[model samples]
Target: MYRQLHNLLLAAVLEGQLPAGTKLPASRLLARELGIARNTVIEVYENLRAQGCVEGRHGSGTYIADLSVDHIIEVPRPVEAMPARPTISHIAPALSQRGQSLIAGAGFSRRQWGAFMPGVPDVREFPARVWTRLQNRHWRKAAPERLSYAPEGGLPALRQALAEYLRSARSVRCEPEQIIITTGIHQSIDLTTRLLADPGDSVWLENPCYWGLRSTLQSLGMVLQPLPVDAEGLDWLAAGTRPAPRFVIATPSHQYPLGMVMSLARRQALLEYCRLNGSWIIEDDYDSEFRYGTRPIASLQGLDTNELVIYIGSFSKTLFPGLRLGYLVAPPQLAGAFSKGSAELYREGQLQQQAVLADFITDGHLTAHIRRMRGLYSRRRQCLLEAVQAEFGEQFEVIGNNAGLHLVVRLPDRVDDVAVAEAALRHGVLVRPLSRYYHQSVAGQRGLLLGYACVTEAEITPAFAVLAGVLRKFVKATSA
Candidate 1:
């Protein structure tokens, strides 16, 4: 009853039926009028007063508070009673050409976690308790300095921790001072593109590269040269005839989607080519941790004698994507500039998180987590492979399965991978079409990128069965 009375008065006040500064009826009078107890009227008035809807003087009755006229006057009417809205006259502002292109080409899914979602790690396997404990430790005595905006290159301790880890784990050569922390590879790449290259300058990218990176470069107005990826990864010979690029972005440790590790000869040639041509190499060493049955490959940055490579890595895969922690190993000569640019351009801060991460790395939690995930992912990868083999026999070819979270299944030329992917999604499976990754239509392949990392071993067979059914229908249709 009190709720009903409170709502009634609130509506009246908001609708301006009881205008601001107008005195409400006395409690006894309002109760008698509504045929309710005086106590209920008192409660309603008290609630209104608490909500700033009304005010009471020491000896006077309650009156409506002075709310803005605009708020009170703009109450929405029922659909049938509302008048027609005015037609828009002037043209609304639109996105820029580059912005439009980005929107058109955006490939990231809103749903990142599900069966066969590529490039996503099993975040469920992450050590949440340990991470929470570390976070708590930092916050327990979070000094004013710790809570404030991070120092120029990020939290000093985090940078040092990253430098040490990279040196030992990935064979990336760099001192602590040369490390610049970033939110993730996107920011790291953005910093490289802005600081090193100019608009209209040529930038060489892997033919079927990560879409997000390609979009990032395009948005910055760089002329992207999509070099083909053979078994060796990024055919440098094919790119010899083209004009020298200002920056060459390569995944030397493990090429994305295709998952091929850049050959040693190719890596060396790439480094030497960049050194001779005065070009910079942005070696994105993303997902180099989970190799199966082979010794882990070292980074291209470590082989640099001429300081031409800018190594980028992220903990997003190893720890979790939400952490958004990554680092760039810059040449000692350019560290200060990178640091200054990072501060001036992005002003990224998350000092307390960085501090916690520093402790997480130094205390051996990060390494231990990676080691455990490697074994788990390896089993899941095998499960997926067996499921695929059981369903398809030898109808398809699997590429780049020795390393990384995903493997590519090359299909016959006549097959439409995009159509198969769409059908699969309708039937509750997620797989990226290989053709969509290519910048040019001429160089596209008909294949599917199946990610087994996030999918559990138990869920793998069923998911693949659904995907296989979709594939079989497509194959039969194409053959007919």
Candidate 2:
């Protein structure tokens, strides 16, 4: 009752219905009229006073406080009395052409947890109990510094743990001092772009890369040069013919969507090319923890003898996306600048969470969780493969399934993948059209990117059945 009255009066004051300096009705009178206790009215007034919406006088009633006229006038109007909103020209100039393009080309999905939503991990499998325990432990300790803003680079313990783990697991050559913890791969990319490259500087991106990365780079005014990717990974021969880019962003461990590992020779050539051309290589080694077959591929950062690589990784894939914990390993020469830039631009702070994550890693929970998820993901991958083969026979070809959580199924040349994907969504299945990943539309080899990591064995076949129905209809229609 108090809450309702408080909200009503607050809204009235804010909307100018009860204008500033207007006296509210006496508490006793209001209570009697509304059939509530007088104390309730008093409480409402007290709350409004606390919020600065009203001011109280010792012997007088409460009065509305003076607020900005703009806010006060922001109330609903009758349809007949409503005024047309000011046009862009009357207010301010329209967004720049680059801003307009970025908004138009935005590709983030509204749904990220349903069937075949690529690049998402099975967050349900995350060790919630263990994480909670670690979090609680930190809270109980309640160190003032831990609760405050974190240092620019990261929590020292977390950085040290990450440095040791990366050295052994991903073969990354970096000290803890070289690591700068970021929110995720996106922030890492943003920081690197701002610090290393200027506006209008050219950056090489894989022809069909992660849409989010493309959007991020484009939004920052970086001139993106799209280089084609074959089975061996990014085509350097074609890249050689193009003007030298200031930065090159690649996923060497597992390329996004396509899931191709950059070949060893190609990795060396890329490093040498960057060395000679004075280009910085931003290696996004996201999700290198989950590999189905063979050993995990060593990171491209380890092969850099010239300190040309800026390695970025995230816990989003391995742990959970909501964690928002990632790290950037800059070269020794650039570490201090990267750290300072992170602080200056982002001012990122989540020290307590960092402490919990540090403990989670040091206590070996991270390694154990990864090991468990790898086995489960392997089974789920097999289920998806079987379902696809059962539904389509040998007509559809699966590519880049040897590692990573997702794979691409190449569709027939005539089939429209976008149409099939839209139809699949209607039938309660989600898959990304391969063509959407490309910067420019290319003919031949249209496909669907299907992620099985978050889907269970039972959900796999049923989901694929829906997708298969959609694909068959599209294929038949297009062929006819």
**Prediction-by-prediction clash tally:** 0, 0
Would you list the C-alpha lDDT of every candidate in the order shown?
A: 0.90, 0.89
Clashing pairs in 1: none
Q: Tell me the deviation in Å of residue 94 in model 2.
A: 5.5
* TM-score winner: 2
* lDDT over C-alpha atoms for residue 59 of model 1: 83
Tens-digit lDDT track of model 1 for 73-135: 786657786645545552122567888888889988877878898888999988889989999
The RMSD of every model to the true structure, in order and in angstroms, is 6.6, 5.0
For model 1, the stretches where C-alpha displacement exceeds 4 angstroms are 1-93
